[model samples]
Target chain A: MAASKCTSLSGALTRQLLDSVDSVLFDCDGVIWRGDQAIPRAPEVINSLKKNGKRVFFVTNNSTKTRQMYADKLGKLGFDATADEVFGTAYCSAMYLKNVCKLDGKVYLIGSNAMKQELEEVGIQPVGVGPDPISGVQIDWANVPLDKEVRAVLVGFDEHFSYMKLNRALQYLCNPDCQFVGTNTDTRLPLEGGKAVPGTGCLLRAVETAAQRQAQVVGKPSSFMFECVASQFDLDPQKCLMVGDRLDTDIMLGSNCGMKTLLTLTGVSTVAEAEANLKSECPHRQRMVPDYYVDSIADILPALQA
Target chain B: MAASKCTSLSGALTRQLLDSVDSVLFDCDGVIWRGDQAIPRAPEVINSLKKNGKRVFFVTNNSTKTRQMYADKLGKLGFDATADEVFGTAYCSAMYLKNVCKLDGKVYLIGSNAMKQELEEVGIQPVGVGPDPISGVQIDWANVPLDKEVRAVLVGFDEHFSYMKLNRALQYLCNPDCQFVGTNTDTRLPLEGGKAVPGTGCLLRAVETAAQRQAQVVGKPSSFMFECVASQFDLDPQKCLMVGDRLDTDIMLGSNCGMKTLLTLTGVSTVAEAEANLKSECPHRQRMVPDYYVDSIADILPALQA
Candidate 1:
């Protein structure tokens, strides 16, 4: 942990790191806030960064919310934000289908209405949201009427994921040409009281195992989410800094997309873990190390002060 | 592919192979019956073998049926099958927990009520059989009340498998001591019209990935099912001739349990698959090759009739 590896100090080096970045990307729920509560002075730090003419953007793997919902939450949390600046997996996934995959048919979406709304916003019709009930009898489960027009299967956070849906996804994906897309491969969702639940990764793996195929992930660490931000804002990677608390998702995404990374330790991962990773022999683990470390996003407020 | 490998012919070599075994194990679907119809003269062949003092038993990886249910199906299809003669994975899994794993606590079963019935028959109280509804809000998925009595998590053919159940299983399995067991890892269940649905293996792999641990599977190819049959019948594995349809599940189970295997083509796999495995360079695939090939279980009829 050298002083040079930290960009929080009010000095020439810290100012230089800040001066080189015109675009600022933030990961929600950890770096800016934890759960329902906003991190102390995090909103102020973000507002200050925006005031300095830095294009502040929110990059989240959370597929459960639409852009409008994320904008509403940001407004309520006292963070000066807009829907256009938010790059959620839900919106990015839809954007990915449109801009990158260039799919012509509807999406066999195994996600939520929020994701459906996002996909529909981009003119990509998403089918198979909500509950797909099972027919108690053993009538050829593989024979579920598949929509021939579905050219892709988009996986996200679905609360109603079931055997029927998983089977249908597998059946549809049997076509080698059918595209498979995932929101993110987050293994667990951390809850209050140190509890956790299965995330999109669990559902995605189930379908992958059954279908025997891989999904093109459109979330953090995949470069798709960052690409969404970069393509939309026309921001240069060298001039953009990604700030998040998680090393695997947010920080890895920054490094993966050739952008500077700032790790704030107000949420999941700790400094000790990052230091160990930096010294690890495994190249994959080493890549997850951030360019800089901070105790909290609030630490950056001092560097931005007059 | 050679005539010498054919066991259907009434020759000296065929008779010698049959004479070497005093016990006979038969797979249910595609071996004795196809869907709801009994294969012509298959039941007659089994009756003749039983009349000749050969120990007859039914072995299957289908976890959907209980022993009693299987016996009823067998009776309806013209086979004289007792509950003791049937060793479905549903029953064998419960037996594996009771005998092999020596589990003393209640089981968190992610399967049907038939599995629960089998567990109860073995005096092992099974919980978590039906739907586990989510709280809708994503506040605390990990905080779902876990039962201390739950000592093992058994995965089987569960139609009601949901995110909440999977999360709860992961939460409970987070305990290092909790045993993880799967009935079988059959990837797909073939239905009428050549349609297929995901089997227990898909569900099992999902849990295995989330828990980051392997489950001790108690179905075909694991030898646990044959061990159950042998322990119940007091028969030697060397003296048993296992008859099956699928090369992977049934024939492999036979090979793993040190029993001679006979493959019939009325089910999932074809003779070309068996022949390919027989000549496979990989020893793992070679082990799945059956000792003899028959066109159908009816191929054994003339041997039994004479």
Candidate 2:
């Protein structure tokens, strides 16, 4: 019935799936690379897909890197990619604030310098980027000098995230008119080994807890990410295939956008997890199940070569 | 007819309510004082309660100060109080880790020097109290040297709360055996002139988000704070009157512990809000509805005088 969902992408099925979609959107980190090292044959798969007259785009939730930085990293890893082909949260969030929110004033940014650069690229001013060391008493913090023009608070991956920054954001958010936006809700940034570090979600949660307000997230699973790419390239969702390692973010985003989804076993989620989602009664979990699963993005190499 | 819930405490009702409870637990900050100033005649009300042969105790969610500091503040405010008669999150959290969790190992404390002293007083060694400044890459952070003896992570109101602290907690909590504890979940610490600063809740939330585990909270509404006081003083919950300003923490704690709850108007929650909780069909909201409402804790003075 319907060729069975979450099937193994192999042989004729891989070729058939490739022919169905004109463009492939790949999630970074686990799908194409682990850390500094690229997954074996993942570069070949991406380059071959481009050579085969199919479009390829790299979409990542990591806000520490801008589009240009991502392109530079991709090139260093031997991947044939361009800055325009990358859609990171840093760039998309700025676009969202400018285009969707039509934010005219400055942003009280609790994020990296990359985010500041992205916001600047879009002609939006961002205040509070670096370490805002706590100096005064609680009353002093409550009365911390705030930028009068700051109309929004943007939370992302900030290495310098501190109590002062959190307090600043809360003070800005006390005015109900201030817009709150977050990059993504990924809890942990999985590294090369079993080791990991806290992600943007932690900082954002801290800010949310203080402000007593939920932030509008711009990363995966939200339609804005897919729409950001589609709007620029005029790409059709139905003719796009989303390949990712994570079921919750990448595959869920594909499902939300009505695009075909393929799960790669090289990342945070497993095939068993996808199957568990398939068998789950929850409609939300069901949306996370991919149409197909591959051992790695390298698995698509034979189909691309053919 | 039965007395209506959330009724205004005035005239004979005040005296009758006062005679009903043998002990009175007062919340600091909004209840007894606003910043450095006492709430009009709140100290007189507290001293009068003690003079009238009612045992009085001060319970606060603030983790910054030790019991001695609270007692000192109470004395300065003209309230008849002692260090033994005060229960704060700083002292309560230390008790929770030592007595409840039966923690025998060192703790990674994301709190203040007061918390450090409390932990030391309880014979539990705590490390990482001050600013753990960030240095090195993400991988370096993931592998940041962790104390092998640290078996618990305690979060409170840390002005030095940083990304490094959050990451360190995540690393410690990665060990499933490590205990996670928080002082309270009060989002804002209200200051004078309607200003506020981020509370312990924000810092604790970040750690929880990163750890992917809920902390054992030791403040208002958790029952631990009341139990800590009652166990030592041999006070009966039924004969205890929990008087406070906020409905969520103070009133909810009183209701949770089966004590009489009074909502005072001199603080965060309003009379209309308590009335709204009374009208709401939610069971949790119902718990938040205080049995009686008073214009101020000063209103009880006339009743005590009688």
Candidate 3:
């Protein structure tokens, strides 16, 4: 299809869009809250969507937080969300590898315990392969033996990562059949004080360039994440609306999966910036322009009522 | 020509190869000492080459260390060297921007004091644009107000980098005429106590990908670094033998500049690994084949005497 032109949807048109969608996927970071504080009218818009019989699901590429943690944060922000109503990249990554990739082999995971637990819950065993692990062999940089059985490489944000771990991971990726997977490609992670180190995306790119291989990213921007969500919730992509702040991840995810994406100016990107980027020749530019633009979630109530 | 089929050269052949070379360039990190520990017999091999009436220069992509620092390290490791004998990426980068690119205007330098000093020496005024500058303009991340006066973007290793710094760099690169220059592309830097962090190369790749613009890398692997050395020392590329452990940076530099490359099995890459990479279908694979493969620098002493 040709690039979708930006149409200034009237109040009537906004109401039509709101009423037509059966499922609404909300990006947690920018759409709901800016860091910790809730964005203006976030709770009201979400409550209104729920009242109108919409299945509200909080979806995020931030693998640092678990579903329960997201639910707790949402409940505290007055959005009235349950643990089951939230989905994250960690969840989708585990599901994709289990279902689509059909990878039942040994996986060298490089994330938190939450990622490990999620993989286990899906009948897949997760093993840490850097220095210390429970079951599988750990490739200690101080003493890297170069194990031959390592079949796959899975990466996420691990604060305890060492050079030896990275070197061993590169060795594993050197093998042709070894699959490379990542939970998400978020460059920056939100910290309590300020933004800390970038996520696994940076490291993944290094390995990808060195090995000359493209990794199968199972997070946002990958249709697999949305497919997993739709399969679990029984929601049709055509009738779903994805609300997000970041253009690369959340917005691209919605567009790639054939879902309507609403760009909120409250998070990582602004409308003017998005418009300028849309004019650029970036491959992901066309996939970024959202179906609708809004200043904040509070504007959603009036548009839905109209 | 014809991929230089004679790999394992005899003693007389090695002497002939050395005699044919007027100058020799070596990469410091993987080629010589990898973070203080000299590769076995590297110093001896270099000394032997010097005794054979060949001018030897240390050309490295390591921008973090200045020429004086390299000289000190080499001196301690039994290789008699002075500051003039060593050429770093910082030196070549400054030369390229000043002479080739003709960037005489103000530059926002994203590196250390050594790099800044080099740029200033080359008549390019260094300006700080990041949030915290020890002695330059504070880098403004959100809105990089780049006027027409800005000539180039000089990137190096900065430990105290922020997202805003990267964002501003991208903004500067967005300008069609703005020259994007990087000191090197080494992904990680070796730290004290066996630790490593993302280096300037990692940051450079991020900006390069976002801007969709290739950076003119002034460090190792680039023929520009070798060109700077050859011009400064009045040497010829055809008579020069570039000796380094890593094939990508050292060997590629020699190959691109029409010099003989020697691959050692001491640092980051192994002999088997380099052979596999040399035979790969990758475009970089055809750069330079090692004229000779040996376990350490000690192997070169006998050949030089013969």
Give the residue spans of candidate 2 off by over 4 A: none
Q: Which ten residues in a row have the lowest lDDT in candidate 3 chain B?
A: B133-142
Q: Label model 2 with its docking quality class.
A: high
Give per-residue lDDT, candidate 1, residue A145.
89
- In terms of lDDT, the best-performing candidate is 2
Q: Write the per-residue lDDT of candidate 2 for residues B1-306, one digit (tens) a residue.
A: 116789888998888888888999999988999889899998899999989999999999999999999999889989889999999999999999999999989999999999999999999999998888899999999999999999999999999999999999999999999999999999888877788888988888889999999999999989999999999999999899999999999999999999998999889999889888888999999999998988899888998887
- DockQ of every candidate structure: 0.62, 0.93, 0.11
Which lDDT tens digits does candidate 3 get at residues A160-204?
343334555655776778888887777654433332334567556
Better of 1 and 3 by TM-score: 1
Least well predicted 10-residue stretch by lDDT in candidate 3 chain A = A133-142
Encode model 2's per-residue lDDT on A57-93: one tens digit a residue: 9999999999999999999999999999999999999
Model 3 CA lDDT for position B8: 58
Write the candidate numbers in order of decreasing lDDT: 2, 1, 3
Clashes of each: 0, 0, 6
Ranking by TM-score: 2, 1, 3
Q: Answer with 1 or 2, whichever has the higher DockQ.
A: 2
Q: Could you give candidate 3's per-residue lDDT for residues B53-148 as a string of tens digits?
A: 778898877676677777888999999678888888777788899888988687767776777777777788877633342122122232445556
Better of 1 and 3 by lDDT: 1
TM-score of 1: 0.92
